[model samples]
Every structure is written in C-alpha cells, then in structure tokens.
Target: MSRSGGEKERKYESDESRIDSGIDSYKSISRDPYWSLQSSEEKDKSSCGTEERLDSAYASSSLTVDSLGDFIEKCSISEGENATDSENNNEEEVNLLTTVTEDGDTILHLAIIHEEQHFAHQLIELFPRELLDIQNNLYQTPLHLATYLNQHSIVKDLVANGVSLELQDQDGNTPLHVACERGFWDCANEMIHNASPNKLAHVLEAQNWRGLTCLHVATVHKQRRLMRLLMKKGVNLNTQEGTSGKTALHMAVELHDVYMVNLLLNSGTDVDAAMFNGCTALHLAVGRQDAAVANRLCQAGADKMIRNMEDETALDLADGNDDILALFPFDDIQIMGRTVINF
Candidate 1:
C-alpha cells in the first residue's frame, strides 16, 4: 500500500509539472515578440489584398498613410511591380528608405549625423535615384544635409544625378543657401561646378523662413570669403533685407570690414542702402559709432540725407554727438555728397 501511495504521489507531481510546463510554453508562444512577428508574416502572405489587414493603420479615418501600400491599393494600377494582376500599373518607386524613423529621418540623415562616408555611400547605393530627392521632414534633402555637413563626395554624387539645386524647403531655403549660410565653400563649389552656374545663383538669392537670403546669412556670420562666392553666384549685389532694409553692404559696414565695404561698393551695392526703418549703411555705422565705416560709406557716395521711418538721419542717430562725427570727419572730406548738417 505504501509503495502504491508513493507511486501515485510521484505520478501526481509529474502530471502537475507537465501541465505547468505546457502552460508556460503556451504563454511564451502567445506573448513572445518573435511569435508576433511570425504571425504577422503569415498573415501578410495569406492576404492577397492587404487593404483590409491594416492593423491600427486607419483606426482614425482622418489619419492617412502615404506610402507603398497606398500605391498598391489604387484601382487604376498600371504595369510595373506585378504581372499576375491585371492592374500592375504602379511604377517601381525607388526605395529611399534604407532607414526611416517614426519621426521621418532617412539613412542619409543618419550618415550626416554619424559622419560616416562609407555608410553614406552604402545608403546611397540602396537607392541612387532617391538620393536627389528632398526629405519630407526637416525640409532638407540629402544634398542639403551633405552641404551642411561638408560632405564633398556625397554632394558630388547627388549633384551628378541632377538634384534640383533650386528645390526650396518650406522656408524657401536651397542647397546653396545651406552651404553659403554655413560657410561651406567647398560644398557650395561642388554643387555649382556640377551644374549651370545660373542654376544655383537664383537659389543663392532664395530666402529662408526668416526672409533672409544666403547673402544675408553670410553677412550676419561675418563670412567674408563666402561673400565672394555669393557675388560670383550673382546674388543681388544690392538685395535689401525686407524687414531691416539692411543690405550685405549695410551689415559689412557694421562689421568694420573695409574690404567687404569695398567689395560691395565695387559690386554695385548701394552704400546708402536703407533698412525698413530707412537707416542706411552709414546710419548703421553711426549707430555703432564706427567712423571708419562711416567715412568709407561717404567715400563710396553714400547719400547723407537718407532718413529713417522716424525721419531721424544718420547724424540724428548719433545724437549729433561730436565724438561720433569725429570718427568719420566727413565734413572735412570733399565728396560728391554734402556733409550731413545736423541742426
């Protein structure tokens, strides 16, 4: 009887252990990530039309997915991806998304972030055609990012494919804008040399979200050499900023760069270019108490009577302070313009 009881107890224990083991296995199969992936694959293969199987895709009727699936669902499909279906008119979209994040970064963006040339090349190879296209997010194409990151080879590769240097972002910024703004001359040259010189020039004058052109950015950053390239690109020698009415010359005068002053003047930039407030470069110089710039502007034929919106002249900004006038001593110089007489 003892032997029988012991045997029965052992059997009961084994049965309980087997049941628990089976339950644990079922739990893993149900909850494991890999199992979920397999189930997804199986489901995908079974459904000839994936339109109905979109899990959480159209949970909200207003939210739309603009991707490969959208292309496939169209009824008027042409002749491209599949021959078996009567409607296969979908064009073979170049797979640009080597790695697209939920937030919309591509592999090219990652290449810039990592500074990985080899990785960039690999990603570029994944879809050579798409390399020329701008991304939906950040308003920067691969070419723009390459310019920003100073990747000359990457820029060369993309520009060779005819990436539109003229393509503007939501801000109206172009590839040249990115380069000139960041002071990346090498990258800017790569784009220009690869195309008709006229193509990027118009883009150079293209403004950004802030209504600032590439020339404006270069001036603000004090990038004198970039100013040279911009002039070569035919950026308006006299393009005035809309809000401030400050031209490249206006900012250059403020920076105390006499060379830039001469360059702008030689390039036909108006020394008397006025800002929104009607303050000319001379006015800006006076405001900064920079006599050198003031004298240079006067020599460059700056009209002394240009007034601000408030009717305050350059001298007025200086408060008719003799110390400020002493910097330029414009009254002493005999030029085409009369000395500003502050009453």
Candidate 2:
C-alpha cells in the first residue's frame, strides 16, 4: 500500500484543507461554544444538522496518539529544510495543534489527562502559550486539570510558560482554588511563588461562583498550612465570602475552631468584621454555645458589644452560659493589650 511522494503530499493537503475549512466554519457560527451548544439543545432543537456538522469537524480533526507522534516527527524533520517546505510544515503544525475533540480537548489536554508525562512534556515545549490555555468542554484549562490531578511538574511548566492563571473552570474554580482545596503544596507553591507580582493578588483572592476565595476554601477545609502560605503571600485575610459575607475568622469561629480563631487573631484579622447580617465571630461563637471559642475570641479582644442584624450582641446571644458571660465585664475591659469596650 505504498504511495508515491506526490500522492502522499496530495492526501495531506486534502485532509488539512477539510479540517481547516471545518474549523473556520465552526468559529464563524459559534462564538461561545458552551452557549451555542446550550442554545442548540434548548431553543434551536431543529438545528441538529448544524450541531452534527460541528461535531463531525471536531471528531475529524482528532488524531490518534500514534498519528500525532508521527506527524510531529515529520514536522521536526521539516524544521531546517528549505523555506517553502518549512512554511508548509509550520502551517500544518498550527492546524494540528488547534484541532480539538468533540469535548473541546486539544492534544495537549489529552496528553496531560492520560498522564503521558514524557509526551506531555514534549508537547508543552512545542505548544505556544495561547495553545496551552485551551479549555475543554468543562472549561478546564490544562493548568486546572494538571493541578486537580496533582501533576506538579505540569503545573510548574505551565506557569513557567506564562499561561493565564486566572482561567476559571465550569465551576468557577481557578487552578489556585483547586490546589488549595486539594492541599497540594507544591502545585500551589508553583502558582503562588511564580506568578507575576501584580497578578498574584488577583489569583490568590479570586473567588469561585460560591463566593469563596482561596483563603476561605483553605479555612473551610481546615488547611492551616495552606492558609499560612496564602497569608505570607499577602492574601487579604478579611475578604468576605460573596454569599454571607463571612470572613475566614467568621467561618473558623462558627466551626468552633479555637486554634483557628487564635491563628486569625495572631495574624491580625479584623476580629469584629461583620457578616452580611451584621453578625461577628463573637456573635456566632456566643450563639453556637461554643464556650471555648467564645472565650478565645474574648481573650483576643473580640467585641462583645457589636450587634447583629437581629439587634443582638454577643452578650445578648449568650443566654445562660456562665463561662461565656464571665468573660465580659460591665465596665471597660482590656484583653490581649487591646481595649475591647467603650462606655
């Protein structure tokens, strides 16, 4: 089944043209893949033909792993050849790199997903920065997937190559969110320590759809180590969650976490920072009947007089708890060298 060089060239050109034309047509029609797919599913139910064509183009462009390796080998061979053939090879490389699966996963994505570490490393070297950020159907960039899968080297390489660290997955989680949530220290460190100084703040503080920042996630997950790392990286400790406006201290207090409360206090967290309902950590501690955490907060100078939306102060919420009520004094008080009350 051997063919002449001319015949092989013609076949390559034909396949390339079909793939390229299909990709261009898809781009022209669907600017946002997720939205377009949804519209086709719900309102434009009759557009099945259009959807099929799009799917066909995506599927047609997918190369088997072996095919990809062989094509990449051919591209490497053409690198130092004459100008015309080199130009053709470069065009083919671009087309191949941009080809996505029906799930919108590029070859680079598949390589990482399949844990082809050696091949993934090779492809990372070959891909341009823009190509490194191609998101799959789940809106997971290769960096997100790599972090979620705990691939430290891939995370390092992707960050070193300057991929956007702020690209959120379908769940609105940045790679940092995934790293912090999963307690992956090395992967999280690569992102925090290597990100551009100006941009690192945004990455650290970026919230998910649920309004939980990386620090909030770490606190909720009880990741003190990651929380400390984030704090050292200058994350805003007092940033509130989007839903209830509860800071990390607020969460720690509600969890009856005395150690966490002390950690936040020592870290200079705003002890009286309020939630959306004007409830402070002190209020939550007192209401939850957590005598230990409430005492810890009081020792750390938590304001007992701050009222909640229900017009209840921590003292008002301390219904019949002598241990909690004992921490408060009717006169002005000083704890941890901070004045917590004013007459």
Candidate 3:
C-alpha cells in the first residue's frame, strides 16, 4: 500500500478506537449512581418512569401509603447521600424539587394536587427556598397549585416558609386571585393574613391577564365574603378592569347583583364611574333593566345627566323601560338647559 493510504488507514483506526473508548466511558458513568444523579437528562428519563410507577401505585387503593413511603424513602436516600456537601445537596434537592411529570408538575405539585398534606409539607421542607417558587410548565408555583387546590395546610406551610405571595402564574394570576376566583375563603384569608402589608396591597390591586383585580374577581364570581375581605384590606372598589374599563361596581350593575352593587357603593366605589366607552354604572344598570340597581345608583349620587361617548344619558338608555323611567320623574329626567321631550 502507498504511504498515504497506510496513514489514512491508521487515522481511521484511531478514530474508531476513540469512539469505542468514549462509548465505554459513557457506559461506566451511566452505571455509577453519583454520575447518574448528576445527569439531568438521565434524571428526567427516570422521573418519567418514577411518575408512571407513582400513578400505578396510586391507582391501587391498598398500595397508596406503601408506595408513597417507598418513593419518599428513595428520594430521601438520594438527598441524604449528598447532605454533607451543602452545595451539591442544594443542587440535587433543587433538581428533585423541580423534577416534573409529563405535564411539568414537580413532586411537590403532585402532592398538593393529590391533597397529600404530609407529603407536600415534606417536599416543602426538603426543597430549597428558591425552589419553592420554581414554576412548573404552566408557570404555577407550589403556592399557586396549593391555592388552586384549596390545600389549606400546604398553603399555610408555603406561606410560613416565605414563598412568594405575589408571584403570577402563566395567566398573570396571583395565588390570591386564584383563591378568590375559586371561592376558597380560608385560603384567601390565609394569604391576606400572611402577606406583608406591601405585598398584600400589591396582590389586592394586581390585575390578572384579563385585567381583573382580586376585587373584580370577587365581584365577577359573586364571592361576597371575598369582596368584603378585599374591601377590609383596602382594595379600590372603583379600580377598572383593563378589558372593559369597568370597575367592580360596573360589573355588579351589569350582572344586576343588587347586593354587590350596594356593597360597592357603600364601600365608596365611584357610583358614576364610567367605562372606556364613557358608559357609567348607571348607564349599564339602566341598560340591563335592573330597576333596583338603578335606584341604588341614583341614591348613591350617580349623575343622571352624564353623557356617554354617544352623548346618551342614563335616561336616554332607559327610555324603553317604564319602570326605570318612572324612577326619574319627568322633571328630574330632563337634561339641563334642554326642552323636555317626554319619553
């Protein structure tokens, strides 16, 4: 063979030998528990299998406690081995805390979802503080999950540990918003009590993606207790939503929720508050043909002559409803400085 050909053959053999050596090294590392623990990809793959086993284990009623115990033990052993090495231990615990199911739920997330308070507490204690706020694929922290699930104990634990109360989920909903929306009064109250004064104010006023504050959410959901709680916390009753530019009073008027309207009005909500389109709460109440609500608005000092973008007053919108028109006598319904046109 030519010298060049022999050189090429030697190089080819050398490349093959290097490839084989690399494969053998990978195999050895894969077999080593410490090395495997350090491999995120391997841990992820194992997490998938572990979740499957968990699901199967949970399916059989008899295996529930035993399976959880076994799983917890396995996780504990992995965590215990690295305890002496604080940095590595933290990293490992973070990885474990954030190890997700197919839906990107950590074990902590699952524990909350399943209402396993003990397991959730254990995970909370084991995970690092920063990891407590680690978001799942949906950007939901453990606090969000616990609040959504109405897990009071878990919520309390998370709050006591200083998990972020104002962290927004994917939809820009804070845990407080979730609690109000879900009608979890206890959870909502817990959040309110546990939050720092500054954070409490921020959370109460914070708008979700739809631009609804906790007050708006309470009003929309007709959660009277939640609304009262927010009010006690000094939530702005007239805070307008981004989408409709309507305050909680506007929503209450539109929904014909007389009690909520009164609640808002008595709490100092702007009775004459207008939307982006310049439609006031009175205009909406009249449009909805809610005579009681209209009466309440008028009593609250809602302006009768306020014109919308269309230059229409509440009376103009109420022209078709005799009951509403009757609320305002002919003299009171007339626009100032204009000839009275009887409806």
Candidate 4:
C-alpha cells in the first residue's frame, strides 16, 4: 500500500510540471512583438482567455503578467508619440522653406535681395526648380531680383538649374530685359548663351510693357556691346517699338549714333523702316540737318522717296542745305526757290 501511494504522488508531481511548462509557453507567446501591434481592444480580447487561465492556475503570477502588459502599453504609447513628433518636425521644415513674408517674399527672395550669397546658395539647392521661379508681391521672381541686383553668379546658377526665363516682373520685364537694360553683360550672357535655341529666340522677341525688346533696351541705354551681343543672337533687326513703331535703327539715327547706324546697317537692318509718324531714319536725319547721317543713310540704300506724315520726303525735309541735298541722286533739285545741282 505504501508503494502504491508513492506511484500516485509521482504521477501528480509530473502533471504539475506539465502545467508549469504550458504556462511558460503561453507567457512566451504573450511577450511577442506581434501582440504589441494590435489595437488595445484587440489585445484585451486576445489576452482575456490567457489572463483567466493565469489567474486560475497561479494567482501570484497574475500581477507579473499585468505588469508586463503595462510595460508594452507604455512602449507603444512612447513610439506613437515619437512618430507624431517626427511628422510635425518634417512639416515645420517644409514650412520654413516655403513660408512667405507680408511682402510676399519667400526666404529665397530675401536671401538674394539681402546679398546673402551663401544662404541663397543653400536655399537654391534645397528648393525644387519650380519653386525657384516664385514671384513676390511686386511680381519679381528670384531670377528677376538677381538680375536686377547684378548678381551674375546667382543668375548663372538660376538659369543652369532650369528657372523659367520667360517669367515677367510687375513691369513685364523678364530677367533678360533687366540684364540688358542695366547693361549687365555677365548676367545677360549667362542667360543668353545658356538658353536653348528656341527659348533664346522667344526671349529675344519678348517685349516689355513699354513695347521695347531687349535690343531696344540696349539701344536706348547706349549699350553698344550689349546690342552687339543681342544682334549676334539673331534678334529681329526690324522689330518695331510698341510706343512709336520705330525700330532700333530709327532710335540709333535719332540718337545721332553713326556707329550704331553703321552697325545696324551692316547687320541687315531695314534701312527705310518707317516710324509711327511715317518717318524713316533718313527723314529724321535730313530734318535734323545732319548732312553726314543723311549721306550715310543714302549709302546704306535708304529709300529717300519714302514720305512722312507731313507729306514730305527725305529730300523735302532738306530745306536749304546743299550738302544734304547733294546726298540724293537728284539731277535737278528745287529747294527754297533755288535750283541746285546734285553731285
């Protein structure tokens, strides 16, 4: 009977060991990271059966299991908080770059206007190409500001990185127009030589609000070298100004610039291109009593027969100057009731 009792006791001990082994396996699965991924309600539902078993099997271990659950919950909350903070940080960074001031100037605009070259460089690299063309309150883009400020390096960088060359500021002036107007050849050259053939063509033809192309600007500013640079790029020699319908050649003659006159003539300018008042360069020359200019126009194949709005030809405007009248090949000239001989 004693030996039978011993066998039963050993069997009971083995069964208890099996119970502990199963509980350890359950605890291991509960500690899995996969469980941490579940929602709080799902985790509670999943753990309910295990929790009831733990409480029934060992009341003392219930506290331990509850503490472990709490630890995981805290960890999950901490991770979520970190994730939210990370998102906020990323948004703030983007806003820092994109935010505009009351003047509608972006950080990049201010950087350039303030002559902060180093900061501008950093911003340029950080900004997307389209953002490089953003205009401020006055409708001036970064490129416009750069050109206006004569920032040659910035202009080069902006153009090389694919900023839109056609964007106009408040005055309808493109960056190229500003460069030309200011005689900033370094800035102008960067834009002109770096542009695609089609784009350069379009820009050369683009006019400002004053109805002046870059060529006209160069001429008005007496930027001879700049004018030559433009002409070399295939600018339209006979493009008329919007205000007066006068070409660059007309302005050159009006400015009494013999060098410009010769330059335009050699560049195939329309010698007899008329102005708004139906006046040709020769008409203005003869009216100004500039015999030398009249002679030059005559030599360049100027049509002296072209009449002005005043119903007068270039010959008619040469009132009494034999030197002016002599430039035309008229054998008989009647001027101020004087019969003159043409040379």
Candidate 5:
C-alpha cells in the first residue's frame, strides 16, 4: 500500500508540472500572436500580407477619421481639467499619438505621405505642437518629410504651427539640412525667414551627422542660387568641414565647376584656401589639368607656389601638363610692373 501511494504521488506531481508548463506556453502565445504560429508557412503568409492587414485594421473603425476627431476633442476638453485629471489626460493623449501602423507611422505621417493637405492642416491645427516632431519608423518627422517631398504648403503650415526647426532624423539631418542638400531654396527661404532672430543663426549653423553645414551642402551640390542666398544670410564662407577640412571653395575647384569656383572667388572666398592635407584650390585645378579653372584661380590671386602636405606646388603637380602650365603667366611680375609704371 505504501509503494502504491508513493507511485501515485509521483504521477500526480508530473501531471501538475505538465499542466503548469502548458499554461505558461499558452500565456506567451496569447501575449504575442506571432509566437503562436507553428511553421514557416504560417509566418510567410502573415508577413506577406502585413500591409493589407494594417489597412484592414485601420479600416475597422478604431482608427478612422472620426476617431481622430474624437481624440482631438477629448484632449482639448482635458486641457482644462484639474491637476490629477490633466496628468491622466496627458497620458491618454500620448497613447493617441503613439497609435501607429505596422511601419510606425502616425496618422499625421500618413496624411503627409498621401498629400492630404486639408486633412493635414486640420490635424496640425488640432494636434499638440509636440506631435509635429514625432518621428516615424524612418525617424523622419512630418516636417522632415514635408521638406524632402517638397511639400511647400505643408512645410509652411508646420513652420507656422511652431514645429521645432532643429529636430533631426535618423541620419541627424535637420529639415534645413535636407533643404540645403536637395537645393530646395524655396523651403530653405521659408524656414530661414520664418525663424525668430534668436533661432536663425542656430538653424543655419546646425550641421548634419556628416558634419556638413548648410553651406557645405550647397557647395557640394553646386547650388549657385542657394549658395548666394546662404551667403547673403551671412553664413561663414570659410567654414571647413571636419572630415576633409575643405572649405566650399576647395570643393568647387575640385569638382572643376568653374561657375561655382567663380562665384565663390568673386564673393571674396579665400582663393588659396587649403584642405586638411594642405592642398590648395590651385593645386587641385592643376592636378585636373583644367587650364581655364587654373587661369581663373591665378587671376583671383590663388598662390600657385603653395605646397600641399605632399610637398608639391601647383606647378609641380602640373608636371608636364602644358595646358595647366601655360595658364601660369611667367611674365606676371613684368605685367604688374608695367601697369604700375603706366599708372
């Protein structure tokens, strides 16, 4: 009888352990539906229709326009509540904004993406200004998207609504950086002009993750008009990027973009500005065998005698390249002496 009782007790303990394990597994699957899938076949079917699932989920009346309007109204009403109520209301408001699609795009993001300008405008007016800077899965705010998509009106609305101009995306590119990179002068102008005097300097000077200033971006893209506008705004013309230590003028010369080089030079850019490697614009021009650019640089008073870190002068870099060598007028001193005498 003792042996039989002991065996029965062991059996009961084993059965209870199995029951507990089953319950824990059920709870895990319940919390995450993805874990409930039995095979790769089920996972593929679920993953393939994610967008469609999101669309249907959004269409299920829980995330409709009416719901958004209701949410806005509720938040507005909660603003006048007592401290305790206000705290709870703020939490609720956060939850409303946190509601997102599978891609982590808020309703505002969708409105901007779909060009629902009227709806976007309504949402902008009703939503808290803080929501304007909320980033999507791409870490792009509505303002960033507007600037990138060239949505002028949306950009204006965002600015007018007091969105943070300094908000950076995943790559640390502020909206203004994107504007400068893409040569969106209109958008850039809007942002600059709309900014408070106190903020204007900060906005213009904000660098991207690559340590490129707005002026650096303009130079890299050969944006003559944008460059002029930025210069007019009194941006530091000689600001060198940390990576290459090359000023905009150096970049202009390197690209062999004579037009940009002329613009920079005429604007009083340091003609002989050198990179971190001590390579001057004249050195780069000679290396490219660009006679016209070389001549322009010489006329603008670029020091051809300047040596790079490699200990090579522009003429030395020219080596046997006659086109570049010929641009350096050997009679420069004679011409200067004659002019002075004539004067």
Candidate 6:
C-alpha cells in the first residue's frame, strides 16, 4: 500500500478506537454501580415501553405481512414481565412515586399540563399524597396551576389527596387568589367554599407582587359573580392594598368596571377611601369622564371636594371632560354650572 493509504488507515483506526471508548464510557457511567438500583428501575420502564411499542408494531406490521410470530414471542416475554411487575404491585407503586422535574413540578403538574387524566390517576393511586406542595419555577403550586388552567377534576383530586387548602405561593397568594385573578369563578368558589377552609377573609384580601387584592383582579376580569361570592363570604369590602393604598372601590373605579363599582358601593365599601395618590374613587370617576360613576358617587354622598396630590378637586377635573358632562341631563349639566370651577 502507498504511505498515504497506510496513514489514512491508521487515522481511521484511531478514530474508531476513540468512538468505541466513548460508547463504553457512556454505558459504564450511565449504568454505574453507584446508581444500580436507579439504573435497574429506569430499565424497567424503558424496556416495558419498548415491548409495548413492539407489540403494537407487530400488530400493525401483521396488516402488511404474513408472519407476526416472532414479534408475538417477544411481546409474550414482555407481557410476562409486565405481569410479574403487576403481581408484585410494583407497577402501582412505581407510578405513584413522586417525580419532580428540574422545574420542581410533580407528576401531577405534568398530568395537568398534558391533560392526562389516566396518567394522573395512576399517579394519584400510587402516591395518593397531595404532593401539591411541589412548586414550579414560577413559584406556583399544583393547585395554582390547576386553578389557572381551570382543571376541575384535578382540583378535586388534589384536595382529596391532602394538599393544604391554604398553601400560598412565593407571593403569599393562595390558590383561591390565583383562581380569582385568572377569572376561574367555579374553581375559586370550589377552592374557597368547598375544599378549602373557607378562610376567604385571608385569601380574598391577599395581595400579589403588585399589592392588588383578589377583588382588584375580579374587577379587572369583570367577574361580578365571583365578586358577589366573595362579598357573601365576608371579604372586607374596604380592604386596601398596601402598594396603592387603594380600596376595592378605588380598584373598581380604576378598572372602569361599572358592575363592580355598584357591587362595591352596595357592599358598603368606603367610596371615599383615598389612595396613595390621594384620589378617591369619585376623583377616578371624574377623571375618566364617567359622569354616571361621578353621579353615582355624588349621589352616594361621595364628596367631590376631595383633594389629590395636585390639590385639585373633582369639579376642577371636569374642565376638559365634555364626555362626562354628556352623561348628565342637559338641565342638570347647565345648572351644575353653579358648581365651583376651581380650575
């Protein structure tokens, strides 16, 4: 052979040797003695799944070919192993063993996201522990995820499995708060009134990173029924968020949610509670040019003379608001000219 050919053969030999070494190294480490039990456990699933797949493969292949005898033999061996695992109750126990992802999600998390009720049931039957305590990277628990996704059955399963009813997320907000924030009225009601401790007072008034309470979220989502439910649960209508120092009524005004505003007012929320901005709900109504809100506030004995940071009164806020004046009767608007024009 030529010298170049000899060199090429040598190099090829070296590369093949390195490749074989790498393969061996990978198998050795992956099946390391230190992880013998785990490796053994891992093989059971992979081998079983492969056997199942092969069984299906043969069944499909039989449609095109005459002989599935060999495939059937292989599948029979696998079926025997599956029977053994089943008889030993390993299958039930294995499925229930909680598996946490790198993101801290339990098997329940995967079930909820994938809508795998069968798989979820397997998990539940195995562990039967609430395991709802597992939090995702977002710092929300399984209940929070289920509530946000509106997974009714999963919520029931989790509650029955013993997940703490008052479990709070990193933000100190509970699952009920998340449900309310996401407009999952049924989930919220179920969590609060049924499965949970009905500590609605704590949850309804809980704040998120923005210091917005459950009522604030409900108003934004126009979840009036949830609002009524929360109110019936005795959520303090006047609860003020620390960040904005805004009451639920102020939040309603900010959202321009007429229904929520009416609900809040009817619930006896202090319509006059001033926020950190020193603006009352009345000022918000006047600023939004919602004369109906303005009229409602004034009729409800809301003092328009309330001052904000700028020391401007609600009447002074009416100067450029033609839309707001449009809400009042023409005669009322004209007569309100007697209203003080502080601006």
TM-score of each: 0.63, 0.73, 0.73, 0.71, 0.69, 0.65
* Candidate 1 whole-model C-alpha lDDT, 0 to 1: 0.62
lDDT of each: 0.62, 0.76, 0.73, 0.75, 0.70, 0.61
Candidate maximizing TM-score? 3
**Maximum-lDDT candidate:** 2
Tell me the lDDT of model 6 at 284.
Answer: 85
Count of backbone clashes, every candidate in sequence: 8, 0, 0, 0, 0, 0
lDDT value, residue 32 of candidate 1: 49
| Model 6 per-residue lDDT tens digits across residues 179-283 | 776778778767666644455455666677778677777776777888888888777877778787888788778777777788888888887889888989888
Candidate numbers sorted by TM-score from highest down? 3, 2, 4, 5, 6, 1
Candidate 5 is scored at a TM of 0.69
* lDDT comparing candidate 4 with the true structure: 0.75
Q: Model 1: per-residue lDDT, tens digit, 268-339? A: 886776787778888888888877777777777887667778776676667556766664445443332344
Candidate 5 lDDT, tens digit per residue, 148-177? Answer: 768878899899999988878767788888
lDDT for each residue of candidate 4 in 117-214, tens digit (9 for 90 to 100): 76677678768998999887667789998887788999988888989899887778899999888899999999999999999998999889999999
- Poorly placed runs, candidate 5 (over 4 Å): 1-98, 329-343
Candidate 3: segments with Cα more than 4 A from true spot: 1-69, 77-98, 332-343
What are the runs in model 4 whose C-alpha is more than 4 Å off?
A: 1-89, 333-343
Off by over 4 Å in 2: 1-95, 330-343
Candidate 2, position 175, lDDT: 93
Model 5's C-alpha root-mean-square deviation from the true structure amounts to 13.5
- The Cα RMSD of model 2 versus the native structure comes to 10.9
lDDT score at residue 233, model 6, on the 0-100 scale: 77
Question: What is candidate 3's lDDT per residue for 1-343, written digit by digit as tens?
Answer: 0124554454344434231121123234334656434433333234342212212111111222334455555455343465456554566645555555544556776566556687789888877788788776567788987887688888888898889988898789999999998899989988888889998888888899999999899888999999999889888777889997999988888788899988888888888888999999998988888899999888888898888898888888885788898777575335532446755
